[model samples]
Target chain A: MKSTQRNMRRDILDGLHVGIPIAMAYFAVAFSLGIIAAKAGLTAPMGFVSSFFTRASAGEYGTYTLIAAHAAYAELVVMCLVINLRYMLMSAALSQKIAPGTSRWHRLLMAVCITDEVFGVSYAHPGYTPPAYTYSAALISSLFWALGCALGIVAGNILPQQMVTALSMALYGMFLGIIIPPARKDRNVLYALAASFVLSGLCAAAPVVSGLSSGTRIVVLTVLISAVAAWLKPVNTEADGEA
Target chain B: MEKHSVIIYILIAILTTNLIRVVPMALIKGPIRNRFVRSFLYYVPYVTLAVMTFPDMILVTPTPLPGVLAFAAGIIAAWLRLGLFAVAAICCAIVYLLSMLFAG
Candidate 1:
């Protein structure tokens, strides 16, 4: 029992070390989220609480967009589901690394914490990951994310109006930061990015498609464009092993 | 939205996101081996980001020129493989300057 406890402590410490960089990364993204939340007319406290409740960045942004537009509840729910669909895949991948003996409750707990960075870091673990390590990493990274959101909200309220408007541009920059590097690396991603851009633009502008609610337009555009891209350039795992 | 409905919105967001995360992990064990499904999932995030950013990005700013300039700066920085912090910081600064110059 003593040995197990010692091992658990060491693992958790190691997890914290890995989690620090992730926390820093999330701080940048969540800071932008804070500004956007404010622009959407959310109170700082509400922004802080929502950030605490949902760590999914894109989903939170989508939620804010819908709320600001006074979208219906069903629309907001569907938009969020679409925005956060990636997490399902991430948790699915992480599930494979967890030991078979882990309890269902533990799996559910880990699922709550599975973000892109957490899942990526966990995948590097050579064998079964201890629950302590996963939980510790999740706790630290999420705490930083929440902290960053709170800081951003406070700063948003305090800053001059001009600066706040300027800061809102950072949200788009953050999204570009996410998609650009990968698009540069792969032709397929480049093609997919262009397709998504043009299609989304058309959806917003063309009279027929523009008539749809923003929530529906976004969902339809994302699904159709991504499906086409996937079918056009299916990533052959056989060719690029472990990509 | 009413104060009460705001609570409902937040809860729904949390519930849907957590549902996706929890349901998949609980049901699927072992790496997904199917190439088609893997490819589809892989493309979802980037495509979603791309679609969400455009049009909205251009419309968000007070003027389209500042918005386009800021977006161009971001694209260039990201193409140079700058880190997310650097890209966002640079774009925000550029957008602020351009907005002041043009919108003033």
Candidate 2:
């Protein structure tokens, strides 16, 4: 039992090494979110605390916009649900990769921190990921994310106007870095990405669909484009370690 | 809004986000067998990021020019397999310089 505990501790540290890069990316993104939260009248602590609980980026930002506009509570809830529903698919995929015998509580904990970057880095891991490693990675990544939000909120008060505008691109750069490597390696991913881009452009420009809220458009377009890509070219992901 | 409403908003965010994430892991114990479904899940990470990034990136910046330039720089650097730090730094520099030049 002692040896097993030692091994698990080792796994968590190994996970943290990879988690650091992801944490850096999250820091950049959350910084932008922090500034937005401040602009929306949220206190720094309120913005930081929200990052701890709900790691969803677009969902948090969307909620801020709705609250500022004084949208109905029901609409806000439904919008968050739709904006964050993609996490269901990601969590389900991760469930298949976690080591067998991982406790229910550990699984529950992991589920709470399933951000886009967390899932991406974990999924790209070659084989069966130990529950401890996954949990540690999520813990580290979320910590940095929350810290970034707190910093951004604080910094928003003191930073010059032009500097904040420049800093916002850090999040965009992080997102682009994440997708480009995979899209370059796989033709199917490239197609799916193109489809998403075109669909997003049309949804904004095309007269009829243009009426939809940004949240609905993102959810609908992601599902439609990914499904078609999967149907047209299904890659076997059975190489995932199942220990 | 009242000061207390912030707490309510955070609660709502936590409840909704975790609902989707937790329910799946709690119920789905094994690898899904359906090829189409598996493929769909596999493709989701990429498509979700792509859809979220575009259009949204354009809107976040003060003007289309700086955002577009920054986005183009990021794509080029990332495609070259530059590490995340490099990608972000390059894009931020480009956006900053362009905004300074044009929006000045």
The DockQ figures for the candidates are 0.53, 0.65
Runs with alpha carbons beyond 4 Å of true place in candidate 1: A1-46, A61-79, A82-86, A89-110, A114-141, A148-155, A238-243, B1-9
What are the per-residue Cα lDDT tens digits for candidate 1 across A62-102? Answer: 88877777778898778877667767766765776678778
Steric overlap count per candidate: 0, 1
TM-score of every model versus the real structure: 0.73, 0.90
Candidate 2 has which clashing residue pairs, if any? Answer: A128-A241
- Residue by residue across A1-243, what tens digits does model 2's lDDT show? 999999889888977977787788778778878887877677878887888788888888887777667666777789888989889878887887777787888777777768887777677776777777777778888888888888887886577666677777777787788888998889888888888877887788899998987778877887888789888998766454331
lDDT of 1 at A150: 76
TM-score of structure candidate 2: 0.90
TM-score of candidate 1 chain B vs. the reference: 0.79
